[model samples]
Target chain A: MGHGGGGALSGELTRHLFTPAYGNETLGGLGDSAVLPLPGARLAFSTDSFVVRPLFFPGGSIGDLAVNGTVNDLAMSGARAAYLSCAFILEEGVGLPVVGRIADAIGAAAAAAGVVIATGDTKVVEAGHGDGVYVNTSGIGLVPDGVDIRPQRAVPGDVVIVSGPIGLHGIAIMSVREGLEFGVEVESDTAPLGSLVEAMLAVTRDVHVLRDPTRGGLGTALNEIAAASGTGVALVERHVPVPEAVAGACGFLGLDPLYVANEGRLVAFVPRTEADAVLAAMRAHPLGTGAAVIGECVAEHPGMVVSRTGLGGTRVIDLPLGEQLPRIC
Target chain B: MGHGGGGALSGELTRHLFTPAYGNETLGGLGDSAVLPLPGARLAFSTDSFVVRPLFFPGGSIGDLAVNGTVNDLAMSGARAAYLSCAFILEEGVGLPVVGRIADAIGAAAAAAGVVIATGDTKVVEAGHGDGVYVNTSGIGLVPDGVDIRPQRAVPGDVVIVSGPIGLHGIAIMSVREGLEFGVEVESDTAPLGSLVEAMLAVTRDVHVLRDPTRGGLGTALNEIAAASGTGVALVERHVPVPEAVAGACGFLGLDPLYVANEGRLVAFVPRTEADAVLAAMRAHPLGTGAAVIGECVAEHPGMVVSRTGLGGTRVIDLPLGEQLPRIC
Candidate 1:
């Protein structure tokens, strides 16, 4: 039931299944979005389907995730999301009021992100054959000239910087799914990151790579970057930003914080020369208040990620074999 | 369970729920696709989710429909689809070979349609919580300059031409679902209509309105045009092309052929002056060999559709309340 988790199985499905079936250079890139050239401009295209259970969650709902998820994908490509196409799959017996609430939330989220819902579709499945609501949003964004960002751009001299704290979104959904709430409520950090990406680009278009650490969290994203660029990543564990509440929840749940998901946060790889200036720019943005540099790309142990422990020892951070939490946005 | 049947219920959902929730003119248009003005180009964007039961139908599977449906939507907007983003929701325990077959079909269909499947996503749901597979495809196409086609452009004296036969797709699905046979197997007429649309445009750019009669077939599509343009439509029942097998099946099944779905055919409203040439152009295309002039827009009895009976009497054709065959496409 968990075949699509963002891990080794997912990687095998893509490599041996989807990529070969597509048989094209575009899909082979396997980036968050695909960049297509038009008459006088470049367009970034991306698609994501949200199937999170319990339609409503802490600080966000499926509606909010549906919009922000695609918007953030475009942002990671250094594009300004301009339009979104939404499709909803509803169970037959679901109430109209519930659908209305979701539609309103999607609309509000699009407005907040400054993107228009250009087109949409709806299909209803028989009552027992489907879940309450599943949303698939595909976005089109304009990629400005000279702004080239991809996982392959990470180089040995580049420094890795995460926009803010991690693991809140994964933990938040787990808390609701398992009915285990900590003393402090951990709200999902689900906010649009387009403006923050724009601020970083404003500082310089030389941002090597930008990725929203979703699904398998910062650890998987880093491993992907390392494998795609044929470089190793070295991280200082103490420098990684983790909220006190999130850390406590992860510890109690016997989960590693690095493998938890974050919706609004991003990991950026910038040249060492532009790291300080870019960090300043990210800090100035509202969504990047906790911006921190916790890692750097290295030439040793290619396609690997290792973190320095507090005891002056280093341990390899393996990419998760499957998701710690399934059905996450 | 049949809420999205492309009938009155679907219309109400869009008008009362979706449009108001979106609160944008782009979505309010409610056309098959939305046209957005890009720098130096007009982009047509559309989305559709295919949840047809028994993934593999008689002539085509959900994979072909997923590609061609969105391609046809963009074609209706006077655009040739250039790119598509596909997302799949698979139920847990589904066989990999089955998924592989669907993927290969999608790739082949996109290649045949001359559009690239640029990006995609896949998610898995628990075994009993979902159907076998649900596919959502969002497409982007570039609209040619000086060609503007929309539902509202169906003015008085516009001649309506249908590309080919109808009702085959719906009957084919019904036969499989209900295990009924009428001595003849009805194969679905699923094919990409982008090239056919291009051929029609080559004859003239004055095609006023274009729609693929999918879920609610020709009756509902004609009604939507009449309502959107505030014009009446008059049709000759004898002129509407229906295959002999499809007619027999519909009769035995107690269904109206006018309300049965078709996947490949399109109904085009063109200026009276250019109607003959456009019909000739359409007939020359492989997919539109059975093209016929079925009706014309009239100024009298606005927002209504009436057809001349084969028995020399006139009858009003009411829009269906819901699909006679759910998940036909």
Candidate 2:
């Protein structure tokens, strides 16, 4: 029932409604981004609309999420993000200062990500017709040669490396969220991951799958990769990194940290032989300081994810039925 | 007042706010589309978010406007549009059948425009958080060789040609709009103009400026050109083609047809000697059957627009402070 959940409902909507309408070769790839072949190069394109309730949150605002979210999608395709287009739908009664702040945030984020906002559009709706502001950003990036990253490329004997701690982004939003905040404020881990991805690719081009654990967090991202490759993912519970604050928040809220959304974390599926090099590369980066090898693709339970718990028990991390929290991104 | 009017308010917002934020070489062109250059060719990039209320009017729905609007923006740069990205913000509780109908319209419109919907995104808002649906489309197009179309290229003695009748789109939306219907029904001229642009380009490459008279209509579009080129546009009232139905509706509504929106029309600035051939080319296209030479750029009264009325008196046509009709696109 949660269409915004980025879980089964979102997947079903795509398969049943969107795919039937606009399905084509490029979209059929169904990667984080669509890889388009240009005359001399391949261009990766992706789009995302942020509808977060509280425009301003602890770590970042909707502006930061708007820019980094699309940048990460493009990066997941092993592309260096180049250009972006942003469109804003604003409610008439929202203050100009708020719009100005958001604009400043976008400009700042794009500058940091090394991508230019090349084109943009703006529209205003009557007071009650829209939230204060909702932003949509679509980006284009250049995929370097020798990079053949894709979810379907993941195979048995591949090591799974998570770039950093999970659930911070969603928990950060929830902390400042109206009627949902906990005692302590948590900052969103919303940072651009393009440079981090480039660092990983520099180590080796054998990286099979690169995913940003975003909307449905690590669990949803891994489930998608597993299904796409027709391979099973075996995650070690104790090895997955989770910040103390995020864990505490999820524990208090009776939520699984795995399903909480994140803004600036990535998961990599690399060849077993190249795991150490890629992990080293990721750890050296500032955004990837918390990198950990949490899991690996296995021959068992193809198209599923099973976690080996510290208690000597195993549990299947299935795709979430609906969104645990809506608009966390 | 009329944030969607695309007139003075829109212009000021771009000049004072957006320009300072994201303006660059490509965006500074400030045409209907921004022309981007790749290695081997020039690409036109444009974005527009359709917040047109009622979603559906007499002749077309938001889906048609979403595709055709971006396609026309690309064609304005003499580019053959190739790819498009569609993003929809739908309010929860909106029926799937309604979404299905909108999708069909989008597919039909894109097919008609000869552009592919390469990528798209959908975000759901809580029922009251958004209107039924709002669509945003950003397009990329390739400009052919020898085409250097821009508003600044409009020189004195360049004849201004209207591709078809004006005011139909706005009047049509208003006619059936709640509490505003007239005695008769009028249809929105919401059609793609890419093929028509191709036909005109086939006739001559010397055409200077191509602009689709949309939200703010003919007067505002001409004012923009005049200001961009530091020239004045002189319009002949009798020569400017306005369909009888639209004229009659505007007369009863006490609205100037000059300022009403048109969706399926374009105004061009071409050398006087090449005007007839261009007009003929426009007429040969179904979308441009009502093509007519409405005016010419003049050196006098630079950066302003004046009309030569049927009564032989000259009257200045200023850009409206706000829109006369909102969401008429």
- Per-model TM against the reference: 0.99, 0.97
Evaluated with TM-score, which candidate comes out highest?
A: 1
lDDT (tens digit, per residue) of candidate 1 on A178-201: 998799888899988999999999
The segments of candidate 2 whose C-alpha lies over 4 angstroms from its true place after superposition are A179-184, B179-184
For the candidates in turn, chain A alone yields TM-scores of 0.99, 0.98
Going through the candidates in order, their DockQ values are 0.82, 0.57
Docking class of 2: medium
Tens digits of lDDT, candidate 1, B70-170: 99999999999999999989899889998999999999999999999999998988887678889999999999999999999999999999999989889
Question: Candidate 2 DockQ score?
Answer: 0.57
- Candidate 1 docks with a DockQ of 0.82
For residues A1-329, write the lDDT of model 2, one tens digit per residue. Answer: 27767888878877787767765566677788878776666777788888887999888899999999999999999998887888888888788888888888888888899887878877878888888999988887789889988899999999999999999988888777745656567889999999999999889987899999888889999999999999999999899998888889999999899999989999999999999999999899999999999999999999999999999899999999788888776
Worst 10 residues of 1 chain A by lDDT: A1-10
Model 2: lDDT to the true structure: 0.87
Write down the lDDT of every candidate, Cα atoms only: 0.92, 0.87
Interface RMSD of 1: 0.9
